[model samples]
Target: MVENINIRVANLQENYLIAKHLYLMWQDIGVPDESIQSNWLEITKEYIDNARHKLFYQAFIADISNTIVGSVSCKIFAGLYPNIIKPEYRKQGYIWGVYVEPDYRRQGIAKKLMEEAIAYLKSISCTKVILHASPQGKPLYSHLGFDENNEMGLDLS
Candidate 1:
């Protein structure tokens, strides 16, 4: 299955498909439809706009038999703290919206997408990368050498 997969850079024309994959990823992680459906289009539009800007955004898709089966998006971090960090530790890249169709799971498609995203970040001189891993994805990320950070969160609701 992995042998037949091809990784390619995504364009604005594929924004809708990327958005669909993102929605599926969220759903697979148990995000409520009510929360995702209501603003899906807007969110997709924002992705398109960000991708178009190209200052810090890029998306990649996994193609199998000319069909998109998985996707991952990456962005260069523009946070204020990054500006203060040492040069070698600055210019962080963030990976997100990783998804593979149910039928494509366990086929290494996600890994390929991540490799492509990481290569892109490296080409752009990103010194570090980060992602918020879903429970199902933690193992894969860990295998890829991604370490856990000390981020904490609380629900005000």
Candidate 2:
């Protein structure tokens, strides 16, 4: 494990860094910059703002000796379908933006961030936590006990 790693909840002022991490994550996974909007930072910031207001959103940052190396974001999921189920049985949380710098990866930074996010979701009384993992992230998530669910998608293009 990397020594002196500090994981802490992030405030609104750090949203820009979180957005930057997310953008880097997409690029790492082969998403072309040209495919992204010119105002991506503003878009991500707006989304985080809305989620913080309308959903129980929270973000975490990983700092090693005062330098930030990673971040993760989680919140109560806003489902695509009507959420009519009882909270006790179906309150689900969503985790996203699980990112770490390439140099800091494989040193457990992402794992620590994920652990922090999981604990936060549990504290919020979430019955389940869900995340869409990238190919490189699937193994780590699986090791964390995330099972494969029946979520199928198709490309219309």
Candidate 3:
């Protein structure tokens, strides 16, 4: 619902900007600078490299006046279930790196980015889509009809 915002599939030329957006997203979520500074660019580069060869990987960007203000990425997860299972049953889409600039928030840019990611996943026939919601982004995901799963975690540290 954001006026004049264009959402489109991101290309290799925009990987660095996507990485920047991801770094800002982590910072917004309170990740330590040391953790993000040393590795974010390299990590995102690797992901982009893999995405070039993997049909399951897709990224979307929200642009206004040629400036990217928001972004999202999705990857299809092929479950560990045996190959005997049907493909549709084994395929799931996992969304990540959803971020919007602080100045551009509340104008539905993130929502539009998510909708594009979801549509891409659906095009590949993924049976379900998933994403780990940040505290600030949980409401948007919920409004988009995402349900919480019983996933639990442990910190060995």
Better of 2 and 3 by TM-score: 2
Work out the TM-score per prediction. 0.91, 0.98, 0.91
**Candidate 3 lDDT by residue in tens digits, 1-157:** 5789999999888888888888888899999898665877998889777865774788899999998889998887644455475766766888889999998999999999999999999999988898888999999999999989998989997
Model 3 error, position 66 (Å): 1.7
Write one digit per residue (lDDT tens) for candidate 2, span 20-70: 999999999999999999899999999999999998999999999889999
Off by over 4 Å in 2: none
Candidate 2 lDDT at 122 equals: 96
What are the lDDT figures for the candidates, one per model?
0.86, 0.95, 0.86
Highest lDDT: give the candidate number.
2
lDDT of 1 by residue, 1-157 (tens): 4798889998878888878888888899998898766789677868668755865788998999898889998888666453777757677888989999888999999998999999999998998899999999999999999999998899998
Clashing pairs in 1: none
For candidate 1, the clash count comes to 0
Q: How far is 71's C-alpha from truth in model 2 (Å)? A: 0.2
